[model samples]
Target: MSEHDVEELKGVFDVLSSQIPALIRGIIASVFSEEAGREMGKAAGAFYKGLIEAGIPNDVAIRMTENYISVFTNLGEIMKKLSYKMEREGKIKKEAEEEKGEEEAGERAEEQ
Candidate 1:
């Protein structure tokens, strides 16, 4: 590729490197937010009620609702794990001074 093409690719990567982590963090926050929890609970309850109305067994409806909730929780967990992995690999910055401050605080607590 030409020099111009390489420079354009690098610029794209620069923007993406900063934005991707923030996007993932935003998604994780939204997914686990209290409002989301309430909405999920309502949706699950409605689903279970609908199933029961259709003559599904109570136990089976409960199992289906549990599975529905698990899907949301699992997605949040996966994103959280991905964020941690990126931080560890230095794909996302953890800020050196922040980490040092946390470590020192932990050491002080341990001595207490």
Candidate 2:
């Protein structure tokens, strides 16, 4: 890609690098906060109770409850992974741009 294209890409990545982290942090905090924890516990208990009332076996009810809780945890994990990957990609792009700039400067110096 041309230098101008790379620079534009760098700007986009920089914006994403900042915004994505803030979004991820907000999501993670909300998911794991004390209020969220309490709500999750209540919800899981209600699910388990409902299953038991419906004549589901104790083991099955427990498993379902575990799965229900996993949904929230999984969301948090996915966001964390996405944030890490974006951060890593941004760093890689920045490093590549820096290296290309150095190479161009060196070539100019040799021609002078």
Candidate 3:
């Protein structure tokens, strides 16, 4: 890779180092046990190996892998929050539909 590419990869690694720990903490809290944390680390390592084997420079691969973890972690938070919001909206809509149905049924009975 060119010098520019190396610098960009270093930047990515810096960003990852700053962000990934918090992301991992959040992920562990939400989905994985402490034991699973170790496995997750190993899996990330394997992914880095695959990237290197695919012709990515080792340093660049490692850096990008760290950034990838951070990106995924942020993505997970966004998705989780979105899902929660959707579920809440669905519940609200269901409740409104039920209320409307009850009102209509009462009106029909009264008319009859």
List TM-score per model, in order: 0.74, 0.77, 0.52
Stronger candidate by lDDT (1 vs 2): 2
lDDT of 2 by residue, 3-48 (tens): 9999798688789887887788888889899999999999999999
Badly placed stretches (over 4 Å) of model 3 are: 1-30, 49-59
Write the residue-wise lDDT of candidate 1 on 12-88 in tens digits. 86666667767889999998899998999899989999999999999999998899889999999999988777655
> In model 1, what are the clashing residue pairs, if there are any?
none
Best-to-worst order by TM-score is: 2, 1, 3
Query: 1 or 2, which is superior by TM-score?
Result: 2
Give me the candidate number with maximum TM-score: 2
Total clashing pairs in model 1: 0
Off by more than 4 A, model 1: 87-112
Pairs that collide in candidate 2 are none
RMSD of 2: 2.6
Cα lDDT for residue 64, candidate 1: 89
**Candidate topping lDDT:** 2
Residue 95 miss distance in model 2 (angstroms): 1.6
All candidates' lDDT scores?
0.83, 0.89, 0.73
